[model samples]
Target: MSVIAVLALDGVPGPQLSAPGLAFATAARHHHPVAYEVRICAGPGFRSTGGPAPFGIDTPWGLEGLDDADTVLLPGHEGFRAVPPPGVVDALRGVVERGGRVGAVGTGTFTLAATGLLDGRRAATSRRHTRELARSYPRIDVDPEGSAVADGPFHSAAGVLGGVDLCLHLITQDHGEVVAIETERQLFLHLHAEAEDTGGTTSGAGPTSGAGREAAHSALADADREAAHGALAEAAYNAVTPPGSSLEPVTRWMEANLHRPLTLDDIAGRAGLGVRSLTRRFRAETGLTPLQYLLRTRLQSAQRLLERTDDPVERIAARTGLGTPANLRHHFQRSTGTSPTTYRTAFRAVVSGMTWPERPDGRP
Candidate 1:
């Protein structure tokens, strides 16, 4: 099992501190074999801001607990601008030096940035603090628009629920997409039900149930059994024949023919269905119309080309069937918030240790 140490400091926000533990616990409740061992660790005098009401928390582990952790996480806190206590920075640096991953959520990125581990790396923090973070840490690349960003082994997330996103991403990296999706479904359902019961909105708030608190343990053993049984039954059915929507083959064809100037009628004919039937089923299965999927695929192809090759904008637009450089620029910027040239320049700078050049057209 992977050991995750959540470093709780004085004035740490309650939601951010507990979100990772809840997420990992939810995953353990669904997986057959438990995957994570999560611990809340802190040094002396550790307390939580408790939102508007201040409170104190006692943990079983201290800074020593982080020594053997596979991952160390720092959650947002009130003292984000204040330097960490003596030895805290050293402990964080030690984790990275020993090949362990480090992550932060919201203002916690400020703490991580203060350690200098994120210098020269892209990081995401709460948008509200973006300007202050950038001003404070001139070397760290702060991306205000990013909800979550992973640069090498260092990860950062924005907002309160951003911790859940970060945890889900980590779970996906450790397990597979299937496990991550299942875990997310179970957790979201639990949170949603809790919200409805309390007459609260089902926003990306942290979990608030006893089950949620004990998620990393055996609290949901029965639910895990039922989920496992259901999965086994599904797998048995899948063994007899492949499972998925009829649109699967059509979607695959679309991926293969992204460079072609395809239309809805062509897709419908290829799927052997009338346009209306094709549209309904495609939306049901893929959550997108055929044309939307096509556009998204082309944009993804264009992004890959920009990242991997030095292809000019017009050539890439032609190759991806985007038609013209201006069209590609409009759509690409709408989708990614950066032009092709700027995106390519930033990506190359990161991957190849190249410096970003000044372009007369104001591209990065």
Candidate 2:
């Protein structure tokens, strides 16, 4: 099993600390053999900054837990822009030095960057903070548009829901697609329903409908959430499509021919291989069958059109080969957790130099 140590610091956001645990636990619930052992560790004086109420939180482990961890996760906290607590940076550095993977969600990227491990590395943070992160850490290649980024063993995610994307990504890295997809279903459906029953909401909406589902989805339409979903989509694509893979030509062809109704035989013919052989090779190379990759590419293309142009959803869907507006909305919401209209609104606001309302947390 992979041992994951989550570093809880003073003023750490509660969701960031718990999302990974929930993801790993969901994986354990669905998988035959448990895949992860998650430990929440903290130095002394740890307190949660945002919750129903201000409260103290204590963990069973301390900084020492990181020493034996296979992965260490840092969740965004109130003090992200401030210097980290003593020993925090060193412990994070030690995890990477000892061959353990390290990742950050949202503003937690600021904490990881403080350790200097991100120097000369491409990292990501909340889109709103990208400029600040770039200015603060000149050595790090901060991707403002990235939802999640993985450079070797270092991973970073942007926004609040980004923790889910990050953890799901880590699960995907550790296990194959089948296990990760099952885990996601459990986490977003069963576990989310249970959470809603208790009058609580998960950081991101689950896949199923339940109490507060509409409200949660509404909340996810903000600028931060839109960025998070885009980043997640990008990260998922990157995870499957590595550099210089054999599937590159096929994928490029799919992108280029998205306006046409594509069939497996059509793809196979283009690749000069039998259908079965093409299917096997495509799955091996991209973790998805050719059809799945084509669908995702179509959705991504529609999203770009939504963001960049005033095209109607029907037109965008037809242009991306999705066939109809209703089909586009169905797949778009299922994949991105938001509607095309809502996504376009948020994206357009940013592009038009319009300022967003202050977040509930009061950050700009």
State residue 185's C-alpha deviation in candidate 2, in Å.
1.9
lDDT of 2: 0.68
In candidate 2, position 250 carries an lDDT of 74
Q: Rate the local accuracy (lDDT) of all candidates.
A: 0.67, 0.68
Q: Runs in model 1 with CA error above 4 Å? A: 194-364
Q: In model 1, where is the ten-residue run with the lowest total lDDT?
A: 233-242
Query: In order, how many clashes per candidate?
Result: 2, 1
Which whole-number lDDT from 0 to 100 does residue 246 have in model 1? Answer: 69
Best by lDDT: 2
Residue by residue across 283-346, what tens digits does model 1's lDDT show?
Answer: 5554455565566556656765665567777777766766556667756665445566766655
Per-residue CA lDDT of candidate 2, range 32-95, in tens? 3345899999755685656656566666799999999999999887788988888998888888
